[model samples]
Target chain A: MDILDLAFMQRALLAALLVGVTAPAIGTYLVQRRQALMGDGLGHVALTGVGLGFLLNESPVWMATAVCIAGAVVMELIRWYGRTRGDIALAMLFYGGMAGGVMLMNLSDSGSSANLSSYLFGSIATVSEEDLVAICILAAFVILTTVGLRRQLFAICQDEEFARVTGLPVRMLNLLVAVTAAVTVTVAMRVVGLLLVSALMVIPVAASQQIARSFKATFALAVGIGVTVTVSGTATSYYADVPSGATIVLFAIGLFVVLTALATPLAKRRAGRTAAAEECTLEAPGERTAADDVRV
Target chain B: MEQPVIALRGGVASLGGRPVLRGVDLAVRPGEVVALLGANGSGKSTAVRSIVGQVPLTGGELELFGTPQRRFRDWARVGYVPQRTTAAGGVPATVREVVSSGRLARTRFGMMRRADKEAVIRALELVGMADRLGDPVDALSGGQHQRVLIARALAGEPELLIMDEPMAGVDLASQEVLAEALRAQVARGATVLLVLHELGPLEPLIDRAVVLRDGCVVHDGPPPEAVGQHALPGHDHVHPHAGPAAEPIRTGLLT
Candidate 1:
């Protein structure tokens, strides 16, 4: 309660809430599209953007957003042209981004690495007013694009080839997803850092899929789970000494494990009941008599 | 004669430097049900894919509803059902929601009007899965899942329906259900092109069959009666001989 009164803590909490909602909202599509690792890939690319910002004395969040967007476009192009799996291109970008960021950070003045460390591990203590503003703007953009494209996104995620055959602009929609994901990773980097940002994107959705029966329900539930983890994890981190990013991601993983453990058996039981009901209906006298008559 | 609903001539496509469709020609007239039959890797899927612009033709001419393939933007006139795979990409979408997506081309800016909803419900009814509208697609049996996919295509009310292996992996009961659904569509004057490994329940509805061998059209004529039996699993060696061995049939007798 005391932490909520502090200005920095308030900003940190707000940032957590925003990222929490936007991350999983975007993650729902990525997870459904089987591109869960794309968040991690963009996060790594964001680090280089952060390093570029440090070297140029610009806003790191904006710089990171720009770099990540470019990285995302390049990654998509690779997927479009490359013969191998899209993950191969993502793996290349993932390592390349981290390595590029570290080298760029090393190339900067001696004191900059300490500043970059805040981004690497995430420090609620460092969320500035400008960073908060950036998160709000980018988060709004991500949310709007995702909501507006919900139908098309769902169609493509269900089956890309089928979506194409139906004449949806599959390629443009895919690029939109990539760019939105890039922005989400950049905005979330301040709350959960580059290393753990993807967990915020993927973990909640993974948990939601275990129980939610509809896409809308799964998306809403994932957002709820994400928000809960980010807010509670931020609060716990403030009271304890651990980094907020790691704490949030760890909390998410714990939630996923618990939800999966609980939902699997319940789902199996429901399936068993449905099967039994179907068998009973099939053996009803009217149907059995018709079958017997046909045989005779 | 009215122009064919779908026309692909000299279609040549290569994937990963390997030719998948080599000089393939296929044409389906309005209200006709033509099946594309082939062995695995014989390019049956690719031919259908090419018509819908999924596969780029290296050297070919394609037309849909009399418009050049390059200029064919009237998606509402066409419906496509891809082969059913085991995974629905892990997206937890209810049957109604999945079927509603087929109406995307008809909806402006992706906004579903009242008519779209009615069409979706009607499609579900046609597939005999109306009761399972709220259930997740993942919960359905393979047959039921296939039926839901067919309903998705039907919701569009497309004049030309192209399906790739709709019967593959489906049980007989579901196949019969799908056959009845297709029959209804054909009755309403819908033209159909299908890729099938064998003509089972769909055989009765098929007006003609085009068989592909190694990416080339080997036979295009009345549905091979012998293929109905040869198409059975474990009966791979029974090849149908329709004409002189020296010449490939370029046109179907039914046409």
Candidate 2:
């Protein structure tokens, strides 16, 4: 089938394109901050959110989104519970959330009501018009916030305590990050399953960082890779009868490997050239002061 | 004598129900470089953080610029630089942007305006990193990163600059560069309060020394007079400034 032939395929493409652009954009900072695991952990927390949605007879997507945001707040509260063991707090949260979700799922007798498999593993073929709309709106929100606070967000991710010392309101910025991660997981859950959304968020950016020369370049490359994985994975699943989630993950990993291989040689060549140039320039530091001031 | 730019009166700070700073009274005036000397857990950093509003005082009053203020929001006039550069230096930001963060307190809801931008540039220039404004902070050497952090702290154009162990683990070159910059800040009429373990290397850089032992001010005088003494042995003297001292010590001396 042509990539956009079916109406559902068109919706799927739109959703993926939207999710692709925003997830990696946010993920770039997450990766830089070394909080890449936050995405995965938050994604798992979304499972209980889905379960809560199923239980309430509300639109499961809306309910799930709400629950996911609540989980984000819960994650923030865990900070007060313990220090230096955020992972332990995260694990406790993850287990408790999952258990609550299971109980909710069983209580509602909705084990099979909402096509739990589709939410857990994801299916592009099942993209509904409503899902497409939700993805677009949430994606827009994510993009706007990320761009508006890009500078501060980047600063906080790089060094929170330092940012605080500079009077950047570090704790508030951290809460914003956690909230954004939750929102990204909620929107992305439609394209890739909740369990797999973080892979999409982190993999492309991880690959991009291996090759890109600067942070901005890495961010751009990650977005490109995200779009590529989503589009290709959708098409491959349509024609090859493979699992969409697995196909998306495999495509991301494949791209990561290829990019790493390509980047290694290029990075080496650039390193050698720059080293020679640096030696020449430093030898006459006085002469190159004009350009050195602005060179990245 | 001039009034203290930062004044903490009868202040007490505690972590986990134990006091770190007990009835600690201190004052820092403009152009004075006060070294907060302490053994590993002496609340030297805690007092500095309290001055800047990073840590809440469990009791007592904190005043910035001679006003009777109770909270950190009131002390934005006082700038702070913590010990660790690696914390903020990891951001892929340029040296300029990192310095620009100093204007956060003055910004409207922390937004950077045109004047804010200029101040950031000026601050970086002050720290001698204006030449490397576009370079990623992480690309710099540790000392360079430390300078950038100082530049950031200076961006606020603060009357008081509080630093917690700015020289810890720093190379000799960085130490000298930072010491010079710190002196320059004081020369510009900014009060400087720094927390340190030993006063040997930093003896000449400071005007006065305020030493804490067991969460109380055990010594408060000129660094020249305080140099020969070490508050205690086996103390890292580099612990967080806000929390109670992590050291087990004789607590009744200052009480």
Candidate 3:
């Protein structure tokens, strides 16, 4: 089989592109909201949703999507009920969901025969045309919602009470964010598997934040980083004969560390330059016009 | 003279199974900047949270713009600013994008109109933040962040703005700017209520003070009378100066 055959590489490339775009689009918000952990949680939730489908002899993707949506809604409801302590609620739901799944899998005799380990760690070789189509659809949905609600999500993530006070339907926006996460988790389940999808959600953003000057740049850079990691990890796995998901995560971690190191020196120099400029200039700090900040 | 924009009677609020606010009764009319004063854990934040529906009323009746709390449509007229600015520190959004969020209650899901842009721009200008409208919030100073938050609240065109510790971490210069902007907000016929630990800087900026202790309203009146009520013992009313003549503190905006 020619490694460069147009169709074979095209399918993999399409999968990588869809995963690259959707994960970071949703991951940017998740990382900012301190719910990066939710990505890990929902990944597990999708696993259970997938497991349930396997036990019942149903289409795993359909079952997983349905379960992921249900899990997202439950997470939202739990958060609403426990408003003041959001982290506690998230932990409870994530752990409880996983426990329920483990028990269900243990009790079902059929679950043992399904080779569910691959689902936990993921197996990209199983990427079917149907799964690819689903990823494409999910990618569109994530992009559209993110772009459409960009301002609202930005404000709410920064300060929900502030956003709520301004009458932004904080709860509905929260649900939208969670649903976006669920969709991303479902799409990612095929590539990174349940346990590791969160790395895809968090590492790229962390790396981008180290170097990007503004929110727009950070998100764009994060998405770019995501795609780069996926492509490099895929290439490395083929060459080295290692697990692709683990390779991808290791590559992302390397990117984050290198970026952080480079960013520190650059940020220090910029600060020094700005501080010197401030002494010579009379313009009040924070008085720069919106245009100036935007340009940065 | 007009109906109170917010009214709570015997309202109670609990957090993490602990009662933070108990039997609290308070009300505010439009254009009034009411200061909430209390020692730590006196339920000041809880009382404010109840008004915005962030904290549910465990008991008693709560109303907004004369409608029952449950019937109060979000963003219809109420606005809130929590103590923590809560902006995502790393997202790549500009100040304009954040201010435009104030219209979330109004815009639904779609492109913003010229009117929305105008409102956002006006909000930025009001807070002395118009120049930084394009700046990313993460790069801002603490004072600038606070002003951006105020800009966010103003973008909603809210009839009532509820701010929690709005001045806590703000620098003196930014405080003056925020105070001037708040005065303008009151002048524009909006109701303002805020929680503050110290009344020195904010004394002159507000119309009245609602003092809270142990989750209940100890006094609600002009700054003078409220100060008097604090001295009538059975409650701990220790001011920074116990001296008999610490000139009647003007509440709201330090300078």
Candidate 4:
């Protein structure tokens, strides 16, 4: 509670809270679509934007958002039109973005490798008011898109063909998902760092699914776990003098391990119930009780 | 004269530049139960998929309910069940949730209204899946999972229902249940189109059978006289077409 007195600590906590809510919100859809690593890819693409920001003496956060959105749209296009070995194309895009970022950062007047290192590892003390403002706006977009259109997203992720038959703008909805996921990546960049951003997005969802039996439960529980880890991780970093990004991601991984262990007993109990239900289904069709002979 | 509920004229589709449907023509009248049959890779699935707009036609034209496929926007009038796929592979979802997605066609912003909820439950009951509404789809057996998928399609309550490989991987009991459900839908005058490997329990309900070989319509007439498995003309490696063409009798590519 005493850490609340520090101005920088307050900013980091707010950023952490937003990151917690937005990451898994969009991440649930990505995981459902079996593209859990898309966030990591976007993070790499965003580095180019961050470097461009330094080169132009503009806000790196906004630059990263623009670059990430562009990369995500391109990725979606690749998924649509690329005929062979699409993953190799994605690998090229990711590495190209990373290399381009390093080159651009070196070309900038004020930017150095040390400055880029902060973006890679997430320095809480460096989160400016402008970055916080950008995070809040980006987080809002991620939350609204992920929650307001959950059913549409769920239908698309569950079965894309059926979704198209239902007259959903499947292509448009897919593009929206990519864009929203891009925004979420940038929102977490200031808190978790681009390198570790995907962990926060995927780990909490992974942890929640261990116990959650339904999409609704998985979504709510994952978001709950995300908030818990991010807030605590931020607080711990303040006291223990560790890197906030690593602390947060490690905390989430630990939670995943704990929840996985807890799910074992729950799964056994569920299996027992399922076995009892199957007993009824396994009854011989012609084997009848006295009711068969009795006239109604 | 009644307009056909579905019409595809000389439909041509190529998946990955390899032609799947080559000059295929198909039509389904109102309240008709049509079965599309073919051997492995016979383009039966592709033909049905093209009707539902999942597979785009590279040549020719498609129309749904008398409107061209390009302009058909009334999707609530149609229900579609794709080939068997795990309903919840990466993310856990319950039976009710999966069924409710079918009802979303009637929704405006994905909000589940009370009527929508009732329709989902009713669809589940149609497939005898109401008992497993709260259970996760991952817990269901293969046959039961197929029933859930059927229930999902039925939830839309469409006038036209399209199903691909609904009987694949299903047990005998579940097959009977599906046949009975299709019977009820036919009784209510709903149109149906399905892709089947064999007639099986559904033989009695099929009003017409359209057989395809190498993406061309080989047979379109009354239910074949064969009642037992492998008694159908297309079941063997080499079968006679009775002089439709003066060329040699074609053999199944797979055989």
> Best TM-score goes to which candidate?
4
Candidate 4's displacement at residue B152, Å, is 1.0
* Candidate achieving the largest DockQ: 4
What is the TM-score of model 3 when looking only at chain B?
A: 0.84
Interface RMSD, candidates in the order listed: 5.9, 9.6, 9.0, 7.4
lDDT (Cα, tens digit) per residue for candidate 4, span A1-296: 68999899899999999999999999998988888999999999999999999999999999999999999999999999884879899999999999999899999998898889888878876899999999999998988898899999998888887888999999999999999989998899988899999998899999999999889999999999999999999999999999999999999999999999999999999789869875654557767564333212
What are the per-model DockQ values? 0.36, 0.18, 0.31, 0.37
- lDDT, each prediction: 0.85, 0.74, 0.76, 0.88
Error of 2 at B95 (Å): 3.2
Over 4 Å off, model 4: A276-296, B86-88, B227-255
Name the runs in model 2 displaced over 4 angstroms.
Answer: A84-89, A106-114, A213-215, A277-296, B1-3, B15-18, B67-69, B74-76, B85-93, B108-115, B197-205, B226-255
Query: For every model in order, what is the number of clashing pairs?
Result: 0, 5, 25, 0
In candidate 3, what are the lDDT values of residues A210-292, reduced to their tens digit?
A: 87856667788989999998777766666687766777788889999999999989999988987987576578787876434
Over the true interface residues, superposed, what is the Cα RMSD of model 2?
9.6
Tens digit per residue, CA lDDT, model 4, B115-213: 999999989888888999988887777778888888988998999999998986666678888999999999999999999877878998999999999
Against the native chain B, each candidate's TM-score is: 0.87, 0.78, 0.84, 0.88
TM-score comparison, 2 vs 4, better candidate: 4
Candidate 2 residue-wise lDDT, B19-49, digit = tens = 8899998887777888888776778877877
Candidate order by DockQ, highest to lowest? 4, 1, 3, 2
Candidate 2 at residue B212, lDDT? 82
